[model samples]
Target: MKYEKALLLVLAVTMTIITELDLLPQIHRMGFYCGDPKLSHDYIGDTVTARYLLLISFFIPFLILIDKNLYQSSFSTYLLMYITFIIGYCLCISSVNFFKILFGEPRPHFFDTCKPVEALKCTPGSYVSTFTCTNSDLRRARDSTKSFPSGHSALSTFSAGFVLLYISNKASDWKRIVQVLCIAWILSCTVTRIFDHRHHWWDVLSGIVYGMGLAVITLR
Candidate 1:
């Protein structure tokens, strides 16, 4: 069993790395324009690194405390469960990244990144071509095309949903409160992506479904 888990972890990590590498250039492709430049500009939300750190900090203690109170499980058991959660998260993220690259849908703030010169002459709702980004940040320009699915929403939901599933399985008086909080957090994260002009409603909806689906499969 240990060997099997180790092999699974290795495979998940390998696939995630390959997906990340493929994302670089794949995200640079042209995507469907869906928003006006004037209204779409918004500050980028929390960084991915920060979000992951926050979720880890929340989960580690929460899981450990739950295990101690409910099952009196050994440290090694808790550790194994934690590692399993991490692997599940990696798989979920890898799958989402693959879809983002495959779809190549433009973000809400795509115009801010693309800065098409020809767009000046084009009427509102009309497509513009033969343009370049006003900003020299190629990375941001590339990311502008990876907006079909909201990564933030998917990741946030995965983390929250995982915890919710664990709580539901455990006998605890705080389960209801935790469940409500988890659902609220997931909704807020998904909504904020739209407010930040990072994704469309449909993108967020798709992400929610994807994340929840994977969480159910992984947790079970």
Candidate 2:
């Protein structure tokens, strides 16, 4: 078990490094125009940071108390479980980033990021890939092309789904209500990406699928 735990920890760390290095894949410009910049502009959601903080806060107590109680209070057991969780979380996030860069689907606010001239009009259902973005912020411009899979949805669902799975397994009574609330929260977060114009509906859907799939696999 210790060796398994160490392997998982190493795998998680490797995935984290890969994600941080941005070494997975590059975005391919599709030049797809989904909508006007005015329609795509909206208040950006801060759920990414909020979800990370929530997971850390909740998981620390959960591991120290609930998990400990459930598993003989052994530190090694707790470490193993925690490492497994980290592996799952990192894998889900890194996979999402991989797909996001691989697909290179344009965000709803592509026009704002690209700042292409209106004169180079794209007919409905057609794309104009020949234009360059006028946005000075290179990071933002690059991010605009990585909208295939919503990172917000992916991370939110992964974290929330993992918590839900833990509660389902470890909680005594009232687990059903907690599970329902978790599902609701996950759905709400997924929908917010659409309202924020950071991702399309399909992107959010794919993210949910990927995240939940990873959670289930990890817990199993």
> Per-residue lDDT for 114 in model 1?
59
lDDT of 1 by residue, 71-144 (tens): 33577766776678778878887888888877877677777775655555666676543346565877776677
The lDDT per prediction is 0.69, 0.67
Per-residue CA lDDT of model 2 for 1-220, tens digit only, reads 7797678768877986797577765746566543545325643644545455346423532533433444444777666666777888777767777777777777877766656564156665554655566778777777777887877777768777876766654644445555566677677678777877778889989888888888789878
lDDT of 2 at 207: 85
TM-scores for every predicted model: 0.79, 0.77
How much is 157 displaced in model 1, in angstroms?
0.9
Residue 199 in candidate 1, Cα distance off native in Å? 1.1
| Poorest 10 consecutive residues by lDDT, candidate 1 | 63-72
Count of residue pairs whose backbone atoms collide, per candidate: 0, 1
